[model samples]
Target: MSEHAAVDQEASNARRGRGASGGAAARRAARSGGGPGTQLTYIKRKINVYEVLDEEGLALIE
Candidate 1:
């Protein structure tokens, strides 16, 4: 192979190694529940709608 081809191949291999390691690290982070930003704050636990709004109140709204 040409010198340029060899250099390109080496760079590509290096990038692949880094990418594999990065993917593993990401998986580990995910398995650990991720960072604070990955929290499920947007998700609310199951709640009984009837408890918050009675049938009469719902009927009024409707």
Candidate 2:
């Protein structure tokens, strides 16, 4: 092959390599909860208290 053709072929091969591996890498990242630069947020709420009555006329607070 001519030098130019050889170079073009190598570039094409590289792009194919990256395309295949890139998808695998992306899938792995997604399965593992994404990759770097991924952020997660959580919301916190207060617990409520309640009162309960028993059959013996006793009150219980929880």
Candidate 3:
């Protein structure tokens, strides 16, 4: 039981750290004049293929 509890705590801490790191990294990415989420760039290049593709696949569309 103690071993299991320790393992659980470790896992939780790891998850929290990972989440925090990811958020920080995302913020950094958004801050360096680059962001679809950071309210900095008007044009976010991270749009996926489907969003970039047009209905017919010929004309460029937003």
The candidate that achieves the highest TM-score relative to the unseen native structure? 3
Indicate the residue-level lDDT of 21 in model 3.
49
Top lDDT hit: 1
| All models, RMSD in angstroms | 10.3, 7.5, 17.8
Per-residue alpha-carbon lDDT of model 3 for 1-62, expressed as tens digits?
A: 99999999999988786564457668788678564454454765775564655577655443
- Between candidates 1 and 2, the one scoring higher on TM-score is 1
**Each candidate's lDDT (Cα)?**
0.79, 0.72, 0.70
What TM-score does candidate 2 get on C-alpha atoms?
0.27
Candidate 2 local lDDT, 1-62, one digit each (tens): 59999999989988786565467668888788764675576876787876566655563333
List the candidate numbers ranked by lDDT, top first.
1, 2, 3
Residues 1-62, candidate 1: write the lDDT tens digits. 69999999989998776565567678799788776665456777797665778899899999
Report the lDDT of model 2 for residue 27: 81
Candidate 1, which ten residues in sequence have the lowest lDDT sum?
Answer: 33-42
| Model 2: pairs clashing at backbone N, Cα or C within 3 Å | none
Backbone clashes per model, in order?
A: 0, 0, 0
lDDT of 2: 0.72
